[model samples]
Target: MDVSSTLVFAGIILVLLWLFSVNNSSKHRLPPGPRALPLIGNLPQIDSNAPFKSITKFSETYGPVVTLYVGRQRTVALFGYDVVKEALVDQGDDFTGREQLPFMLKATRGYGLGISNGERWRQLRRFTLTTLRDFGMGRKGMEEWIQEESQHLEAHIRSLKGQPFEPTFLLGCTVSNVICCLVFGERFNYEDKQFLRLLNIFTEFIRFNTSTMGQLYAIFPWFIERLPGHHHTVFAQMDEVREFIKKKIQEHKETLEPNSPRDYIDCFLIRMNQEKDNPSTEFIYDNLVSTVMNLFFAGTETTSTTMRYALSALIKYPEIQEKMRQEIDTVIGQNRCPNMEDRKSLPFTDAVIHEVQRFLDIVPFSVPRYTLKDISFRGYTIPKGTTILPMLHSVLREEKQWASPWSFKPEHFLDQNGNFKKNPAFLPFSAGKRNCVGESLARMELFLFLVSLLQHFTFSCSEGPDSINLVPEYSGFANMPRMHDIIATPR
Candidate 1:
């Protein structure tokens, strides 16, 4: 009953109460995941060398919804179609916000469609959809642009004359030009220095994104931003892209007539002026620059990489390539370029392209989403501000979704009667409101470009039959195939 004894007893009680509360809160908030060490959290559990593959393996052991604490934040990962669909489709708006990664936020300033969320996201996304539609995306005009670009790509490849050359540049050029046509109202010639420089910046940004320094920056941006490293180089590259977009915007503003919009930049400028006085307008110059940056960044690498894989896959499976060529010849012939409408009649070719996307599954884990409010799923509570990562690759390769998820079978997309069948689980572009804005354009480009090239030539491995490697090269952000030469001989 002495004063010192009373103080000691009170301290013990306080410690016990704090420990009890911590234990209970951790149990309810956290999902099933591997144990983490102090400070690093589950960083060591992640294989930085091959993050996607590592994450996929981790999901297998931890079930579909696995939580990992990285730095100060906890990320809830949803694997398989059922889980991803339920969160993205069944409960769309609840998980529409994006996790604010330090590096991305610094670079984008929480602008643009990719990383920005909430009201800004709504307005930008709606405007983008409207502008894209007005510009003829998913329509005949856009199809014509794709067909033209596909022919240009085919001609460039044909000029290579089956030599041992890298197709990366050609593919990037062709793919970027599609966006160029949309945004700038003109496509650049292959040798244009400005276009080449822009592509170089894009490549560097992608390369930097997959670097360890980039990962470090995301985890500890406060420390990394002050230090000198590849993060600076990455930021510089992003700035270069932004500058290019800004220059184009300036040009459009000076030349574009308000009464008639010529391209994406013009449309954006007009909207920016229209919303200048509005307090909640996200249509400012900075957002416009970043939006265009996102378009080129997302639009180019993904479609180009898929096309590269398409050719590589064709070389690996020559019989399938030959069959596709035969189908193209029978359906569209070689006199004219392949068009989007041709997709209906060319079921085999369509199936092959679909299989390419499914097999490759670009953007494996989609750009992360953050919960704006408390949400419950499968008896677990996902608290507000919790990060949700929809494992798109897992969904694409889910056993319940596809009969041969691991194999490259075009028949998975074909019916018994040999017609192209739509699979609900085919979500390479993702699902819900935040799905890829370029989905329609990307589809048209892939279908038209693949069919056009196949119509003109046959792709065969330059290496001996035994030396082909189907495993993709762990490139920057996207999963690119290993550098392999292919002979594109005239059919």
Candidate 2:
């Protein structure tokens, strides 16, 4: 053979050998998953249309811990309670980090508690827990706040005067007001223009984050950052929320009486000053803004959406609604607003709320986490820095955990004696170190507001031949019910 021909032949052999070695190496390290084409990974498999349901399908085929590639990065998706619990709790410290998406990094500058991990996460999380406790989250003082807000919510609903109205705005007002009381030390009137704008921004941001575009941004942040899309709108809304929080912080700073901390912002400003000289302190204006935003983001939407579903379920099943109404009337009289303390005495009400959370599963797949170090789970080695998407929806619907996993049966939360029974699978607030910090507050709000509303009004579907659709329409980051009107008749 000629010299040129021999050279080309040797090059071809070397290239083939390298490709073979690379493919074999990937087979050993990567978890079993459906085949994917180059560059796209399993993006085609994802019904960008309904990613949550699509991921659930993948779980069924690939087992609880399925690995998928988004662009060049591979992520481990843990479905079901056993796998999710094992990764999030058993190896908690090893998987506590968060993936830094471009928009979030730009918005938070790597300061917020929700996405920040390691030392920053430790300090901020500890301080937040302590502050919330001091503010009476699980105590009587916070319960009083919830009770007051519940009354406000009930009064607003009563103003509907048996008209067929959508409960979205009222529920949003009630949930947002609870956070407002916590952060700003007061509640906003239902008609407050500024508060309404903030709520609108929040709703938009949530919708954007749960869209296919949001997933694309997370995967290809560099490319998405420069492009104009809903992702940009999300970033803009984030800035608006942050600026509003900053203005509130400034107002608090100017009116500061150091000895007396009035609200979350007041307490945070005091901490920032106290830790001003500490180089490692995560307490600052940026962190404060992000923390307040986090509270608003986490607290408002999830609770309100759950309440919306709860009421919709009640409207669909008038029998359950009447039963719940009777339970409320019998347990707590209608003379005054229902209190958090009344939850224990009202088992059916509590069970109904719990069932709503479980069945709706607002956050189908929670905010994703990253493995901080090499960890082994169920005979699979999850490498450090690998993203973990825990399918919380699977846990909420796990057959092993509940008898009727797919139904809206309140009996799942009620024992044979007709008392509220705590199920280990009821992990709507999630579990482990990253378990919801505002869980107690959320519970108090849901219980007090739901029971209070029921006390004042009995929700029913408006006069229509079509029945209320219980199926949820996927939106942003929550599984929200389709827009429907309810007739809130006075009980």
Candidate 3:
């Protein structure tokens, strides 16, 4: 058939598909939402730049649980604290299926832990958690790793000689090194050219994923893949990352010692051999490569971005910075590097760090979850294959949850007695069984790196506190803080 004939034929099929969807949706009692167009459903109603904010506005009309669409994909978004909690936490298993995002599917070639479900997800996640724990993920050995990295970070800053510099890459290197030690079994020098290139790829991947082009690719993969755009560069860089991981795996294979697993890669290699006899096993080379990609990318960007944003928070609030410094000095003192043991004694500093994560609600929309089978939630029957978004931004900023939900107040994580208190609503790593696998590691890095920085330096900017905006530079995939050139004067 010619192009025009194919176009006409495709149009007829789309009309039929949309009609079938509308009819089935009613029969399934899908949640109520705004009216949608045939092919492009609710995409027109959303702000392409920041879809979550636009979706939040939809909650104003449709109440808490509502159905919407991006193109032909039917999506149910759970808003507010109670409803989100009901689905993600209270009814966790039913909603545990991870959506294979088009971009991620392309990056991982539909392999790996980050986007896998069913037996694959269970096997990888279980093995990953167990191996990470064995390697001191949240324990004293991990604390020592961070404490040593803390000194390296401090030295890098001191070399700046109080001159103004953007903390994005430096913080990226610091946080990336901690994860590197866990995964690769060694840390790269701060000045290494190749190490910096890898971190830069992580940042670019994040930036592209949040860009308009990224959303376009996710919603219309077939068309976007054919056309020339920024998405192409992203995939290329991702391939470069994959190649790097593959090379590292080869080297680890040469130096393999099953009795003494050096890091995550070594442990995974050992597991791969143990499961080599089983046909149903998920511990294979493809998984090792992709899972490492997942760990490296997720491990590097999220924590490092949080660290960079943490500094932006301090730069914006010098008083808060000084207060944290005082707490660090009083508790841990300036003579030694800050450790996890010092957290309880440094309540105010701890509160400030928690507040920073909350105020800058990174990953505003948790990674999308899908319904693997027909499921009923909140008296509504949602059919299988529907997408679910438990909007973390809504939960974090829910009016009923915090006294000043929109403000950057450290007291949100503090008590009347001035001790650090935990808030169930503070979910930067998200919640439930499918929550961040690197939560403990990220926490340790945040505490040690921030405390160490606060201990040695009093951060400020020439533009003054009034100039620093707590709002993110980008608002989609992640809430990235605005980068600023600030001076870190040694205390």
Candidate with best TM-score:
3
Predicted candidate 3 versus true structure: per-residue lDDT over 1-491, tens digit per residue: 99999999999999899989888888898888999999899998998778899999989998899899889899999888788778878999998999989999999988999999999999999999998888899999999998898899889899999999998888888888887888899999989998888889888888888888888888889988999988898899999999999999999999999999999999999988998999999999999999999999998888888888888888888788888887787787889877788899988989998988888889888899999999999889988999999899998899899999988999998999999999888777878889999999999889988888888888888889889887787877778778888899998
The 0-to-1 C-alpha lDDT of every candidate, in the order given, reads 0.81, 0.80, 0.89
Instruction: Give the Å error, residue 442, model 2.
Output: 0.6
2 against 3, candidate with superior lDDT:
3
Q: Taking the tens digit of each residue's C-alpha lDDT, what string does model 2 give over 273-315?
A: 9999999888978888887888877778888888888888888
Q: What overall lDDT, based on C-alpha atoms, would model 3 receive against the true structure?
A: 0.89
TM-score of 3: 0.98
Per-residue lDDT of 109 in model 3: 88
TM-score of each prediction = 0.92, 0.92, 0.98
Q: 1-491, model 1: which lDDT tens digit per residue? A: 99999988986786666455435447565668776544466788777656766777878788888877665456788998888999898988777888886766876776787788878888889998899889988899998888788878877877887776667778889989988888888899998888888887776666666666766777778878899777787787778778878888888988989999999889989988898999888888878887888887788888888888898888888889899988999989999877777789999999999999999877677877898877888778777767788988888888988999889999999999999999988998889988999999999888888888888887776565456676766632356567777778887
Q: Of 2 and 3, which scores higher on TM-score?
A: 3
Give the poorly placed runs of model 1, Cα more than 4 Å off: 1-29, 475-477
Candidate 2 deviant stretches above 4 angstroms: 1-28, 101-103, 463-466
